[model samples]
Target: MTGDFRYRLERGGVKYACPACRQQRRFVRYVDTLTGEQVADEVGRCDREDSCGYHLRPSEYFRQTGTKPPTAAARRKEPMPEPEPSSIDAETAGRSLTGYGHNNFALWLCSVFGEEIAFRLVDAYHVGTSRHWPGASIFWQQDVTGKIRGGKIMLYDAVTGRRVKEPFNHVTWVHKALKIELYHLRQCLFGEHLLAADPVKPVAVVESEKTAIVAAGFMPEYIWTATAGKGNLKVVKLGLLRGREVTLFPDLGAFEKWKAAVDQMPGVRVSDVLERRASEEDRVAGLDLADFILREQAINV
Candidate 1:
């Protein structure tokens, strides 16, 4: 009953090659989102109630391990505030698009990919520049329905194309900066608008907006998107991908966490390419999909 513990459908009920029955698509696992850990190795349950009755709950695992379960108070659900009308109108997002020269991220992107490719990305993702900090950029989150959910403003090192997290973490939200009182912010996936644009294309989800943009540039086959954070992969946000093929590319050290989380959601697959290919040093450094792509691009160049 812990707020951090919630049950969700595994792989949207996609049948996988079951270990017990050797059948497909009948496994679900309990995950602790707080710590990004799977509760137990054998906690996955098969849906075949009779034939493959492989079920293991977190409670049972805790009992077997002699560990105390979360208290009822910790499990009590807190009321979520209802989303009010967003004050972040389209005009606000549009304004940031005016000056790319000031956008450090875009400038860096232009250097790596050239102006033509970089500008295309700028237009495709609606990348913008913010005066909040010189060379700061804004990643606008627009939903499939064409609604501007919110904008994440961040500062980046123009030379490296990496976020400038030092000096007090240069990141902020549009609604908060504007001081729009009672603005109920309902965030959607970054680059979610692409889902409506191409329904047939499979989805490739990543952890950062920067990664999504870079991946889409290199591989245009899949409709790339970003959850914007490791812990932001909420079940509600994934509802859009219910009927589509979705693949998750978590950063190094995140494969197991993402695999466990996506196991309950059908049609979602977590890639092990990084896990298999990355060295121990790469894993420790937390290299992501973008790093690999960049490294390969450099090699070719």
Candidate 2:
């Protein structure tokens, strides 16, 4: 398939430059048939910003991905992925974030964090595998500055031939691969979830997936989605959280800034992770949904 796609952009109203050439292209405001909002500045990059002195402004590279120009009817017909089924009896939402393609770790990520961060992961890691997990495609995100926001590991199921769908599936595989206990898997997944959830999510975002797992223990359900680097936050999908309430869960290192960002969101709450309250050796290090479950068990004990 051809990589170069074209869009009719306006003369001078767009934000980002091209990733390849860094040229500032013109904007082409189109009436979004669904939202009815005039969608200005299509997603794209410049082709001439580097080699040529001219900046091929915004809305250029978005077309570069090879999407066909939509007619009035076709644009209206485009559909979005449906939200995950929510069961009131289940008491909690089935991981707000859906899995991207097939990464076992990525799915676990969604279970822990809400959907916003999972989309961020998908944007970053969609490029296929690298050193971390050979032959495995990671889902992740990066800001326009190319900073890595967050990401996760993934694997395929043997019997089903389908991508493993839940945190338990990832843990089961990890248990088999590393001969680790459910405790470890629980700790890792729960820890990351904590970091992606809660009060004042941290923001000294880093790139190492394992490091993210380790840091996850420090915060519950904060915004710890992985990115390739800075300048790639555009990949982060806070939009997925349009109507829901969210909290800030920061990584161990960047708590202050992370807290600030969380405060900025319209409707988010925050809580502290009580590290000293643990009675068991494997108790999740920080307070989180996972730790919350542990606490309930602790009270019963």
Candidate 3:
């Protein structure tokens, strides 16, 4: 409407709206051999690029002519759906598929732990399929005797009512057992243990149950639990750190993701866990603390 406006070509039939005032002018229709009769352009200009400082591209005629793009308020992506209750509630029961725990896994767990220890078959699906363990095994620890006579790795599968298959591979079975045991401990003892470990102080957090176990084995000074995944950091108890320090020792692989999230917590301090001299001699390096411990024992023997 003012001298500050000039006509410019946008597209064929689409009207040009001022980038600033958004005032639109009627566009003339035109026909092209290729596109046929189409509003291929808009003619308009703003002398106010200095004061108003906004320009519209001829290609924007599609938008100007068709319909305005949704406002920024509307264009934003929907917030990621809140982590579902199933994911957040580790205690919630999951679907039990029949295929899980179809093998004779009790024999396998007893071999790893001991017959004297309370060992039994559990549904792998119902109890919660092991993220790391292939089949399943008892979830407990042992004493110095390399036996579960005093300790029990109790595995309760969330899926089937029966025991799962035993591993054909010895090394694989051992590794699977350890993994199952670690996760079992986390599912069973972690919340209570970590809370009690230091009722009055902040706790150290690790990413893996084995890591937490190994660290606790060496230094009973701090409380710890692995949230399973880096993204699961929110599951760590903020209440435990009401007015204390939270040292985190994420596995080497998860350091960066862990660090970024750890600092977001109010009083979390990132730290490291040093394996004992035995660990070094055993050439052990992995996310699972059980691996570290087993390697140490093997190397020592």
Candidate of highest lDDT: 1
**Descending-TM-score candidate ranking:** 1, 3, 2
**Model 3 Cα lDDT, one tens digit per residue, 1-301:** 2111222333545554554555554323232222232323332345455555454443455455775333445544567554412111222122222223432243433343344331212321122233234443323222112222111222323233222234432122223433433222212223223364345654666664434544444454555455544466765656646677767766545567777875667877764443333254444433244444333532121
Clashes of each: 14, 71, 26
Q: Listing every candidate in turn, what is its Cα RMSD in Å to the true structure after a full C-alpha superposition? A: 16.6, 19.5, 13.8
Candidate 3, residue 243: how far the Cα is off, in Å: 2.0
The digit string of per-residue lDDT tens for model 1 on 36-151 reads 44565456677798977877777677777888655556544666557664737888789888789888999999988899999998899988888888999999999888999899
1 against 2, candidate with superior lDDT: 1
Give candidate 3's whole-model lDDT.
0.40
Model 3 segments more than 4 A misplaced: 1-84, 87-199, 213-221, 230-240, 252-257, 264-266, 275-288, 291-301
TM-score for every candidate vs. truth?
A: 0.70, 0.25, 0.37
How does model 1 fare in lDDT?
A: 0.78
